[model samples]
Target: MNRNQHIWLSVFFSLALGLLLWKLKLPNLFIYSLPMYPTAILPDFIEPALDPNHRKFFHSKRMFKFLVICLVILLLLASFKSQHYFFWFFGVLGYLLHLIAESLTFKGLPN
Candidate 1:
């Protein structure tokens, strides 16, 4: 898909995931409210970084993989701590969803 297509798809998927979470009545969903809204629109800002000539590493698949790993670690840590597992699971799921959305674009795949 093109950059614009990726952006719209990401927004749609993110919103759909958010609504699903909301309907599930998950606790601490409010904490994600701000991030979730911006997530739907983040592709606009992110597309520039995906430019092939850009030197920045933010648009790399390695970075997304690292982020996913980090989130999973956080989820694991949250599980061992006094925090709720559902919250951590949802957070990780959301992050993964974001990555998946990005993966639909050309820049999202690994080179």
Candidate 2:
């Protein structure tokens, strides 16, 4: 699918996640939905400036793994009476969802 389609899908995913969190009485309601859509597509915006190969570098398996580990660790570290945990948690969620969707595209994903 195209970028717009991917974006809408990501937004839908994010919103659903947010609603689930809200229903479960999780802290920071809609936090993931708010910034996740943009966060999910950020690589598409930055890839041109960062690399000619685009998604290959930014969306690489290694990068995704590292990002997930770092975000989860940071989220856990900041979870205790800290508001910043929301940013990290939502960012990670959005990024993961974006990559998962992108994997289905013709572009596929890097190693």
Instruction: Compose the digit string of candidate 2's lDDT tens values, residues 38-63.
Output: 77777677563244346767777887
User: Which runs in model 1 stand beyond 4 Å of their true positions?
Assistant: 1-7, 39-56, 80-99, 106-111
Which residue pairs come into collision in candidate 1? none
- Per-residue error at 86 for model 2, in Å? 1.6
**Count of steric clashes across candidates, in order:** 0, 0
TM-score for candidate 2, please give it.
Answer: 0.78
What digit string (tens of lDDT, one per residue) describes model 1 on residues 1-111? 444654565567656766776789853554554344444334336655445554234445776677677777766766687455445554445445555665665555553
What are the models' TM-scores? 0.54, 0.78
Q: Which candidate should be chosen as best, given lDDT against the real structure?
A: 2
